[model samples]
Target: MVISPPEKPTRDEKQSAGRNVAIVALFAALGGMLYGYDTGIISGALPKMSAQWGIDHTRQEIVTAAILAGAVIGALVGGSLSKRLGRRKTIFIIACVFAVGVVACALAVDAWMMTFCRLFLGLAVGACSQIVPTYIAELAPPQRRGAMVTFFNIAIGVGIFLANLVSVVAAAGDSPEASSNWRWMIGIAVFPALVLAAAMLQLPETPRWLIENGTVGKARVVLRWMRPNRTAAVEETLQIWAISQQEDKESRGGWANLTQRWARPALIAGLGIAAFTQLSGLEMMIYYSHTILGTAAGFDAGLVVWSGLGIAAVYLIFTAVGERLVDVVGRRRLMLTLIPGSTVFLFGFGLMFVLTDHPNRYLTLALMLAYMACNAAGLQAVGWLLGSELYPLSIRDRATSLHAVALWGSNLVLTLTALSTIDGLGLGPAFVMYAGFNLLSFVFVYFAVPETKGHSLEDIEQSLRDGTFLPLRGNIASRIGLPDNRITTGAAAD
Candidate 1:
């Protein structure tokens, strides 16, 4: 006698599962908003805080770079912390730290106190940068992974927008009392921290993490909830279990696994992309655009602060656009399409700065906006997304922490040196240097980064093991359907 397999989940059931997974991803993405808000708030607050505290350029740089320093340390320790404590718990700890750190910053009595608190706050920011996309990527199906993982990017844009809006609103007062309003800007982030902590209670541990820890039954249940149907969930569970066992036999985990021959490509791609995301000058602008515009471009202080609002608006808008484009055009194609525009726009921006002490303000604004649009849509959007997807599941936590370290460490160097560099080399030359970085980024991505869109985590790991992970002339691997792009029987597209 032959027996038919259990019936697949119905269409309604599939829809329900997808909706549930989306909700979970959205909640997790809130951590990114906290990261953005805390980091972006300083851009507007710095001018006021500097005035209020009677600080010099060196002190201001210290205050700004403090959080980045802590973020580097957070990324350094986060891999071990997340691996031992689990992703969900690590995020909860991040939320708590975010709350406490913000509160401490609000109450800081001096520049030194604020620097310490920002450093403390950066622990959450760094850890969130490492974990949120990783968590979302693990839960999302390959078909939906690009868009879903980018939700973290979208949330960060939202947070930056909110920080800028708050700054603009606070500056609208412009009274003697308004000098202290930076405290309010730094303090208001606590509510989002609270929200993220509460959301963690309802989210499940990732199926991959559970499988690695030998909780295969719970992993299957999570996959059932996260995937479209029971059959797909069961198949994925088996795949993850098999990979976990094979990896166990292959090497010891930790720094050792990352040094393996197979991991070399992912290391270069992930860490190189991470460094370029900063070296390309996005973070430098985000943190110090107001200063660059007001001091270097000779814009009015009010217009400079207001430009932060506009810059953030463009970032949010294009990041949302990139969310759709990444999945539709694929990761490699999207970046290649947008990055050249960034290089060109930045060079033009530098030319404007070189033209005169007082170049055309409107032209400068136009170039800055155009550069932001291209960078936000391309490299900035892809950097974190690639870090989350490139490594094998066995070493993903460690690899992502390294990715975050490269990102935050580069950010730290840029933050500390931006003012000094602009002062010494002239703003035009500094930006021209950034334009060169963008050009170099294009070369690196074209040669090193492979197409990862629409490929399952297990399929990517298999490619690495088989030494087939490199990109072809036009990503023929994806076009030829080498990866597991097919849906399981009775399972709907996620």
Candidate 2:
């Protein structure tokens, strides 16, 4: 006897399809929180630790930048490791590493010890930065992919905000707290690290990754959790399986695979966006916000830490704005607006420093808040979209690894030299330098970064291969493809 097929899902059932995905995105984004927390905690902890450890500004740079160094190493190998170990397992392992690193940092007696501890923390942060976006993309519905991925970055801002708040609270204490408060500030990350570790035990691997590993049954199971209808899930699984099979046939996934002519432009686009994102000084601003406030604005530690709270608040808010606006406004348009707008604010941020009179502390405050808001809305917001999407599926893991390496390496150079640059050229000149980078970033985005706002994965990859994808000038990507939200089972309009 023949069996009847499962009926199409009702509209409410379709709406409910994303429940599991929403839960998954929440947990996945928590790993991003660990990344944000680990990196962000240092902004507050560094000043206090520097004083207690008796390290000068130069030593602080070494200590502060060491994590970026470790992150670079982590990004370099993370892709290979994720492929071998599976994304779920790799992220679980990263969580464990983050816990150990934060605790070690808390216990450190000197800059050398803390710097070494931070290296491990950085490794976890770097790996999460590379893998989380890819993982999220694989799980998210096509129509809402940008919003889902942006969730991870928003979590990063939350981590930064929490870090700044911790600093403000610590600064309110008396003498003993001032000297060793860095320990409490840095050590708090351990809780979230552990939370993510626990969360991962319940999470499944992405359907794409599972399919790639010859576990089609497992892929189906995961897809059921991600899509609204079993019919849709089956369809999506088949689509993902087809892409995986084709990609595997096309490339073996290593440095050698990355050299293919078709792959090169996508690789360059991803890497260029990554490099430009970091070089625009977001890392420098993030890793050194409190320090910049102190040095450039001449705020005392109390004032600096308090001001940081404002910066962090604005960052969290605007990143959320960017998150909501990404799919609505289109990736390239948002970038076009954000990058150029940020340049104006960057110049304003620098101009305030140019005059030594400190004539208007309120104006300085306004300029900084504006700069932070715009940067969060712009560069910091959209930087990951290109890295997450531009590469071909066959080489995505390795390509993203390389992209992450470019990101952290650029981060390392900026963080490692930022203070020195300030020392050598002074604050006004340093801000001006960063502004120039943002100006340069505007040029790059205008000409290179394509709009992938509504394109399917297949169309996006094909466009990149055909070289029609770059320099996107409209809402829709140039393509011929299936209906929108191709991965979801919900009726195209249901």
Candidate 3:
């Protein structure tokens, strides 16, 4: 009978490992920071770029839509690249591209050149949109995973706020048409991208990805690093290994697999949430903050930039609160609760336009701040994490690609058409249209989104395979005074 293998690490060893994992996750979140900076910087740069280039609304639409167009391609291809090269490597590549694109935008001689540069940057942003949430979720433990992954989104909001603040300071006491100032606003993002690339060199690949590639021993080592104790680490390693082996045996490849009954609902939920995330009018708010304040509220460039800072501050504040509460409150509940409130604000925001023959800048500002708070506390924090975690492990990356495609695709369409809609439909009606979109988003979340607060990745996969992953019937029906009709008490026929 010989000595059995050691059962546990020493307490000191466990503590050290947990500390290391946390440090790594914090660094990995830099990717989200870069994503936010690149996206947010452009919002501030656009006005000066338009001034310098003498660009019309159509060209403004093209310039803004270019990055989104690149993001669409990036989202579609990012999963495949991550599948081939691994997440950390793909992210490093994205960081490099972001650096190059940011510099290119800052130095571009014309609107067309700037548009092309943005296209390159969008590719990286789009890839980060898929990769960061997916990467964070795979590394975190179930009990704290929701909050952990949401930290990535919170980083994004912070980056956005900081980028806008920089713009405010950069433009302060300067003419609106100053050419070099926009370049500085656009170029400052390169520092974060550089930091992200440097930080990634120190992080490990996710354990599930390692196990899937036949590195079970290494996967166990990483889990031990993340978990608080021995039993938990071993148990999770077994759980991940067992599920991965089965998924490899039965999981089909490619989009065709999503047509299967067990896979369809998750795909629908993934893509629907993605599409609705953009349709929440987030891009319009962030990208066009200047335009909305100017057109509807009659604010000058200086006033608009100051108001942009206010919106960014509100966004950052609530996103932090949402990050902490995502696990405590549950994803579906948080989204369902906040979206209706955001819709109300969206309508009120539009109504301010309707009531005022001229601009009621303060009232519009109040409504915008309230809307930002609801969005940050709910949709903006929840959407990326949900899409990353909802699919089966076998097809997660591929499904994420398509889901991200829908996200950026929706973003592109909205950004391209926002000015036109405001022109064609009037600012009040345009706001009303956004309010309608927000209302539909609430209905969709109510009827379709599932709660994934405490479930492990493997448990969620098994639930999807069994057609029991969605609509949280007991909870939803209870909330609405109806029977739990959405619950699947028995197996599907297929």
Using lDDT, give the best candidate's number: 1
Q: Write the per-residue lDDT of candidate 3 for residues 208-294, one digit (tens) a residue.
A: 888888999988888877877677788889989998898886555666666768877788887888888889897568888877787
Tally clashing residue pairs in candidate 1.
0
lDDT score for candidate 1 against the true structure:
0.87
| Candidate 2: stretches off by over 4 Å | 1-8, 176-178, 472-494
* Model 2 error, position 160 (Å): 0.5
Q: Would you estimate the TM-scores of all the predictions?
A: 0.94, 0.92, 0.93
In Å, residue 406's CA in model 2 sits off its true spot by 1.0
Report residue 397 deviation for candidate 1 (angstroms). Answer: 1.6
Scanning candidate 3 in windows of ten residues, the lowest lDDT window is 485-494
Q: In model 2, where is the ten-residue run with the lowest total lDDT?
A: 482-491
The TM-score ranking, best first, is 1, 3, 2
Report the CA-based lDDT of candidate 2 relative to the real structure. Answer: 0.79
